[model samples]
Target chain A: MHSFKAVFKRELKGYFATPIAYVFLVIFLFFAGYLTFRDGFYEIRQADMRAFFSNLPLLFVFMVPSTAMRLWAEERKSGSIEILLTLPVTIPQAVIGKFIAAWCFLGIALVLTFPVPLVVCYLGDPDEGLIISGYIGSFLLAGGFLAVGTFFSALSKNQVISFILSVVACGILVYAGMPTTLDYLSNILPAPAVSVIENMSIQMHFHSLLKGVIEFRDIAYFFILIIGWIAACSIILDERKAS
Target chain B: MISVKELRRTFGPIVAVDDISFDVAKGEVLGFLGPNGAGKTTAMRMLACFLAPDSGTATVCGHDIIAEPVAVRESIGYLAENAPAYGEMTVAGFLNFICDARRIAGKAKKEALDRIVPMCAVGSVYHQTIDTLSKGYRRRVGLAQALIHDPDVLILDEPTDGLDPNQKHEVRLLINKMAKDKCIIVSTHILEEVEEVCTRTIIIASGKILVDSTPALLKEKYHCSLDEVFRKVTRTKKSA
Candidate 1:
């Protein structure tokens, strides 16, 4: 636990020590606002945060990978990984510590979008439960994507490759559950296979929570996805270190 | 205390650390001498628990490197080759991070930092980002980090690789000063370092130990300088 805090603090401070944190925050906020308002937030004629929350899965598919790409790849590239892993910290502690720090950073980014909900409340009477659930779902979605990005970051020593791989992986997860993709898959594949792929998509669970109904199954899906990917990351790093 | 038993590791078809074995008790400064790509760094890395051996296992401070890596790590300070650190972090920040990872905190953390910062001569660059510091200063910062926890064993790979002559002398002095109570393993091709600081010398070539003896005895056996002794043993190993 002590070691976890050490890694978490170092990684969080690392994000702010460079320009990456500020640049990411600005761009993320700009896009969140742009995508929210660009889709005619006011024109939708709903005083809820549906537009803001709806755009997050795709937005996080791109943004979370950028934040997570350097988590391990940069350490390997700079040779600091040797020093880091050699410390008393265990592999799981280091992986989860970094994952949570990046998750928290994304959480902060999600919080920055609070103004959208505030403005919704200002404009008209909005469903407060829906807004809260949307934020919860968004945070979980970012963690899900960040976990995949962290795994890819450990898989490759080059940050660009890690970023690209993460983007592709996260993109598939987001797009797999789209109506168009599921419809296309249902025509060729069997019902069970199509549902399996649909169930695996991050958008499905996120959309469930966005309905203001935070079901246990949806939350479990996100938790399982994040934990499974982070575990894979730890295994990859351990294997890489061994050979 | 450190012990190795036929420790072997390979990269695919090539053996990086062959079936080699040696041990260093506390208060012994073991100089690991070998040519480039001679498995010095690989052997040291295995001892540091950064890499696992393919066949055999080693133990540090009564903990096996493979079965008890975290325990082994907790008792050793490792300075990797080229002294890698977070470039964007200031010297102070980097050391503090190491302290934090080592579980040093509160008054203990402050005392550890206070002792290591000046000992490694990184006080002048404490506030500067590691990337902005000179090579000598960065190396010192890496040294400071390794020493922060005050572990029983020190695994330093090429500790003087980037230092000036004066800095090198100071580091040698530091090693000599600390050689009385800790088990130290210093890997370098610099023969003078072995003579100046190491109490015992192990020369390996092609992932195998060719000669393990004191510097004075190795020189006397070869009837020449330590440099000539290193060349003769390593060259003989290559030709044979």
Candidate 2:
């Protein structure tokens, strides 16, 4: 736990130490607001957070991966990974510590969007419960994508490659649960297989929580996905250190 | 104290650290002389618990590296080549983070920093970002980091690789000052470093031990200077 706090503090501070935090914050807030107001038609529609919740998966497709791609890739490139692992910290502790730091940074960025919800409350009567659920769901989804990003970052030493690969991998997960994508799969495959594919998509689980219904299954799905990816990341790190 | 028995490591078809064994006791500086890619770094990595060997076992401070890697890591301070550090961090900040990682905190952490900063002559650059510091200062910060915990074993891989002659002499002096109570391993291609600071020297080639003896004994046996002995030994292994 002590080692975890040490790593977490440094990694979190690292984000703000460079221009990465500012760049990420500006890009995240700009696109999130633009996508919600433009596509969801915030002015033209009812005063609900549906637009904000619906756009989160797409926004995270780009933002969360950027946050995670640097976790290990930068260390490897600069040769600091050797220093990190050789410390009294274990590989799993380092992985978890970094993951928490990135996750918390994303959480902070998400909180910065509080003005959107405040505006919704000002405009008209909206489902407060739904908005809160949407925030929880969005945070979970961000974690899922960050885990995928962390895994790919550990797999590659190049940050650009790590970013591109994570974006593509997360894209597929988000793409898998789209209604149109499921419709297309249904025509070629059997009903059970299509359902399985639909069930596996990150968007499907995320959408369930956005409905203001905090189901145990939905939360478990994200936890399982995040833990699975982080485990793979730890394995990759250990293997790379050995070979 | 450190001991290795039949240690071996391979990278797919290439053997980076072939079967080799040696022991290093306290109060001795073992100069690891080897050509590039001759498994010097790999062996140090194994002893430092950064890399695990494929076959054989090594113990540091009486703890098995494989069985008690975290304990092994706790007892050794390893400085890799080029002295890598976070570019954006100040020397003090980096050392503080290392102290935190080493699980030292509060007053003890401050004391550790206080002891090493002046010992390494890094006080001037305590506030400057590491990227902005010169190469010699960066190496000093790296050395300072390794000495922060004052571990029983010190594994420095090319501690003075790209320094000027005066900087190299300064580093040698630092090593000499710390040589009495620690098992120090300084891997270098420079033969002069062996004579200057190392009490014993082990020359390796092709991932194998070419010679392991005291500097004076190695000179007497080869009937030549340490530089010529290094060239001849490494050259013969390359051709063989």
Candidate 3:
């Protein structure tokens, strides 16, 4: 636990020590706000963050990966992975510590989108429960995508390769949950298989949480996804150590 | 304070560290001399608890590396070749992070920083980001991080590899100053370094120990200069 806190503290500060954090925030906030109010037409719709919640998954497919791409890739590239592994901490502790720090950084970026919610409240009364749920769902979505990104980050030494791989992986999860994609799959595949694919889709679970329902299954799905990816990450690091 | 018994590490079909065994006692500086790809770094990596051996066992400071890696790690300070560090961090920030990772806190942490800054001669560049620092300064910071916790065992891979002549001398002096009461293993290809700082030397080639003895005895036994002896040992191993 002490090692975890140490790793977390350094990693979180690392983001601000460079311009990467600021660049990611500006890009994420701009697109998130623009997509919700301009593309989704928040002014015409009811006073809720429905559009903001809907657009976040797509934005995160690009943004979250950017945040996570350098986590392990840069460490390996610069040879600092040696320093980290040699520290008085297990592989899982370092992995989880870095992951949580990146996840929280993403959470902060998500929170910075508060102006959208404030604007909605000022214009008219909104479903505060739904807005809060949407924020929770967005945070979870970011966590899930960041996990995928972190896993890819561990696989490569080049941040570019890690970024591209994560974007492709997260993109598939998002599209898998789309209704049209399921319709296409349902034509050839059996209902059971199609349903399973839809259930596994990141968008499917995130969309449910956006409805202000916060169902157990949806929450459980995101948790499982994040945990599974991080576990895979530890396995990779262990293999690297052994070889 | 350090012992290795029949340690082996293989990468696919190639063995990197093949059935090597040696013991390093307190107050002794062991020079790990080897040609490139002789598994010197790999051996040090295993000792530092950064890599696991394929077979056999090693212990540092009375703790088994495999059974108690955390204890082994806490008891040793390892400086890898190239001295990699976070480029975005200042020297002081990086040292603080290392201290935190080592679980040093409060007054102890402050004292560790104070002692190491001057010992490393990194005070002038303490606030400079690592990316902006020269190669020598970056290497100094790497050494500083390793020495921060003041571990019982020190494993340095090519400690003076990239430094200029003056910087190299300073690093050797620092290592010499810290040699008392600490078991130090330094891997290097430079033959002069062994005579300069190592009380004992182990020359490795092709993942095998070619010779293990005191530098003066090895020189006397070979009846030649240390450089010639090193070349002859590695060359014969390559042909074999």
Candidate 1 lDDT tens digits, B150-240: 8899999999998999999999999999999999999987889999999999998889999999999988888999999988999989888
Q: Which ten residues in a row have the lowest lDDT in candidate 1 chain B?
A: B116-125
The C-alpha local distance difference test score for the whole of candidate 2 amounts to 0.92
lDDT by residue for model 3 over A59-174, one digit each (tens)? 88899889999999988888999998898989999999999999999989987988888998998899899999888898899899999999999988889999999999999999
lDDT of 2 by residue, A194-234 (tens): 99999999988898998889999999999999999999999
* Order of candidate numbers by DockQ, starting with the best: 1, 3, 2
RMSD of model 3 against the true structure: 1.2
Q: Tell me the docking grade of candidate 3.
A: high
In candidate 2, what are the lDDT values of residues B1-240, reduced to their tens digit?
999999999989989888999999999999998988899999998898888899999999999999999999999999988888999988888999999999888999989988999889999999999999999999999999899999989999999988889989999998998899899999998889899999999988778998999999989988999999888888888888
lDDT of 1: 0.92
Give the clashing residue pairs of candidate 2, or none: none
Q: List ranges where model 2 is wrong by over 4 Å.
A: none
Scored by CA lDDT, what does every candidate get? 0.92, 0.92, 0.91
Candidate 3 residue-wise lDDT, B107-205, digit = tens: 999999999999999999999999999989988999999999998899999999889999999989888888987999999888888899999999898
> Residue B42 in candidate 1 has what lDDT?
92
TM-score of chain A of 1: 0.98
Question: Which of 1 and 3 is the better model by TM-score?
Answer: 1
Interface RMSD in angstroms for candidate 3 = 1.3
- How many angstroms is residue A97 displaced in model 1 relative to the true structure, after the best TM-score fit? 0.4
